[model samples]
Target: MTSLVDLLHHPLRWRITQLLIGRSLTTRELAELLPDVATTTLYRQVGVLVKAGVLMVSDEHQVRGAVERTYTLNAQAGDADNAEVDHDKLRTMFTVFVAGIGGHLDQYLTRATIDPLADGISFRQTALNLSDEEFTEFITAYGELLARYADKPDTADRTRRMLSTLIVPD
Candidate 1:
């Protein structure tokens, strides 16, 4: 069986997973959100995820003789244990991650609002020098901080945000 990261090697699946993490959306909605991908291609990728038990059809309704499915991440099944640090898998993941970042940035720059300071936009890469123990402790703390917000209730006062991190030994 392909690992979760391997399954996510498909850009469409990766993007779908990213979008569905905390919310549900219909197939039509996903098509609208990912206009660049052909509807057929998107559907194919989604089907793979559904088969793999990562994406669940939360709801379905008949519309004009057709059934529309609303999908949400099946948190339990979608969960992937911390990825093993295999070179090939890491390469594939990084390729997908960088492509996603490029696509998002291209779209974001054209938007009407892009206040770097006001919106807290940042793009910087820095090297870190730390003992193995220190690195382990730092990453562990970071993960805990993220877990603290995993179930934060949505509120009008808070806007959705994406945090992308790619840490590799130098």
Candidate 2:
């Protein structure tokens, strides 16, 4: 549990876990999603998570003469019931995680030749209410769905990209 807590304490590790919540990605692919971070730095963070058993190298392939390892989150390492985690530390970690993503997107939009205005990409949020049992059922089903596709191979033809999902009760 200490390993889990340490892995979650790092801002970069937290962001990586969030990005891989329901998906697996190579270090290069993760770097692409988090353009603000140096690839080497991302690789080092990944190594720490891997050592901590919070992440595992699910696949490996040679790309452009370099070997790339794809990682997936270890479900057993993260506990929704762990009371040892410091809320304040988690909050600070999450803030940096969100800011890193936001900064990357902002810089990409500002400097890239492609116009986001012309493109159809967008962000959205929604809310829903559920009873206690219903919420539990929903969470169980969601976890099952994520587990089903967590080991899939990364394909060039797929139109899908990594997406972040946050469920907060109000």
TM-score of each: 0.74, 0.57
Worst 10 residues of 2 by lDDT: 157-166
Per-residue CA lDDT of model 2 for 27-57, tens digit only, reads 8889988888988899888998898788988
Q: Candidate 1: minimum summed lDDT over ten consecutive residues — where? A: 77-86
Which is the leading candidate under TM-score? Answer: 1
Model 2: how far residue 2 lies from native, Å: 5.2
Q: Which portions of model 2 miss their true places by more than 4 Å?
A: 1-44, 57-71, 103-111, 115-120, 140-152
lDDT of 1 by residue, 1-170 (tens): 77777787777788898888678899899999998899999899999999998899999999999999999998776355354657787777788888877766776788787887887678889898999999999999989999898767668998766678888888
Distance (Å) between predicted and true CA of 21, model 2? 5.9
Q: In candidate 1, which residue ranges exceed 4 Å CA deviation? A: 1-6, 36-40, 59-68, 74-86
**How many clashes (backbone atoms < 3 Å, residues ≥3 apart in a chain or on different chains) does model 1 have?**
0
